[model samples]
Target: MPDPEEPDVVSATDLETPPGLEPPPTAVRDLLAPDRRFVSARRNLGSFAKTGDAARLRRGIAQYVRTGYGGAGTMSRRLGSVSRTARSLSQVLDPGAADRGLDRALLQGNSVAEITDAVVEAACSSDGTLDAEASRESIRNALSDLLGLYSDVDLLRLTDAQREFVIESFVAHDVYRRFALDVGKHLVDNAPTATIGLSRLKQARNYIRQTIAESFRLLREAGQSMTTAHVRSTVANALTNSLVVFEGYLA
Candidate 1:
């Protein structure tokens, strides 16, 4: 069995709903809406990490294959495609449903050590099969890419407290409650100015940064005194590039 405490690398397969919640049209529209898109993707990535069901993975794979081939390319290009789908799903589903499913899937029957082991295994794999070096590179490169995919709105909404809460929950609860909370709050706020695109972009970037920072921090800290080289470097590069592409959205 995998070590109980290790973090698991959530795969695309984790996002599918069981029989009943067959995605309503309203939900789908919310997911596809420009303002909601970033939030949607954030929720979806959290959902995907928890469930790991094949159907969800299929949707992600279809998206991945369609947008860009994964095996070879700049890491950003690959993660950008996958991240978009994650955002869409996050936007479409009820945040409650996503949270519940994720919590159930992750906390089912493992110690923290086990979870950590699973994460290490997943990181080393390519397409769910083990390949240590590939997995590491895939993880680092893809995450760097994924974080880069966020937009200005994404950065604007996330507060430091929210980020800390997300990291805590992922460790204790195995669910990204912050994502759901953010989306729920977003929906309830009902700001007319927030377009689906902007909303989604905002949500997506928040998840990307929080997840990347948390994971990188944990891994870097696990065995030795941590260094900021990779983490800061990655974030800095992403911020720089994002500024180039997302200047219009920035106020």
Candidate 2:
């Protein structure tokens, strides 16, 4: 018989249909809201770019940064950061170049988490006291700058499928980050040996990645349209179930 105190080794069968696995609003909203905002900002930036009105573009960038980056207060600081980044883009106004950049950023398997990580790593000093707020500001600015490169025409021309792919990719990356954080928190709290913690975390990451891919596949196979709510529910259910299994392992 299996040891009662040993952590349960989860399998494909174990992951199916977790009982009473209701998705929590906190997790759902945390993942969904930013994704929606990011998608919306891309669409709006495309619209503004089409007009070729510099003032409108600036205003749109500020609004997008405020909404998509965070919330309402401290608008001036965010706007300034965004504006500075926008100013740094190549002034040649070549829509083709801008389009290529946008494609590389969004469509080439790039994730917001990756961009944020890059910015944070670059911004941090030798000391452990990293200015997290500054890192976020830089990320917002970087995104705004990238969007500023393309004309509205370039952005508007993208097919629906392209936009959907970008949105889904962002959601997937966020899900991965959340799962990593959850596993890290558990390991930290439990004070497991480094080797054990690292091994468990790696396993958890692989499982989460596979679960997310399968969830998307099933949705597509069923002819169901993907939405923030649906993705959130699917991810949250998987994460909750995985955590239960992980806690069992820790026990």
Candidate 3:
């Protein structure tokens, strides 16, 4: 979990973080006053990262729940063209989306989720905090899937990756929205230990990463086009299937 617990007057270099990941500037802080949740979460993150005591992580989660974890990170959004730009894409809606059962079968595929997510994410964003690097990740994921699953397809034409960006951004946003939301829950649910919690957190993040990537692979094999209704319906359907997958894993 990220916490903006640093000094209010840090340098320009202070915000630099590793590529392909959301920066640590997630939690809101006052100019002169430290946020209580951020201060506590920072302490917990530092402690768990250092000592491997899952109790610290667990306690932090409880604190977050008590403090109201709502506006602290990314938010969930509708799956269709969630932005004004999405409307522009609608001009190109595939005429065959209804005819070919693309919306029916591929709704469970990766492409629909990727495309709808790509658009709807804008609607979900509260302000202009969109990350530039999200597209790079989705594109890579989309391209890799093309190489693995649909090698004969033209790379330039295949574009579930934009959808990939939407979902990736969604995940990144969700994590910060609620500190320690799921990172330590599994470990603490069974037993509280930071080492186990850290490991569980890794597994959870990996699950998210793999699921979205696997989901992106099915978006192409044709020039991409779909109605806004198709977009919403397919993505919604894809999300349901994803939940089933997630539930199976959790079970």
Task: Give all candidates' CA lDDT scores.
Answer: 0.31, 0.35, 0.36
Q: List the candidate numbers ranked by lDDT, top first.
A: 3, 2, 1
lDDT tens digits by residue: candidate 3, 98-197: 3221232343335633644443333333333333233233333333443555545432233554333433334333333223332333232343443343
lDDT digits (tens) for residues 9-85 of candidate 1: 33333223211112333423344233332443333333433443323322322232222222213434533423322
User: Over the full model, what C-alpha lDDT does candidate 1 score relative to the true structure?
Assistant: 0.31
* Cα-based lDDT at residue 1, candidate 3: 26
For each of the candidates, give the backbone clash count.
Answer: 41, 4, 12
The TM-score obtained by model 1 is 0.22
Better of 2 and 3 by lDDT: 3
Clashes of 3: 12
lDDT value for model 3 = 0.36
Q: Give the winner by lDDT.
A: 3
Give lDDT: candidate 1, residue 185: 35
lDDT of 2: 0.35
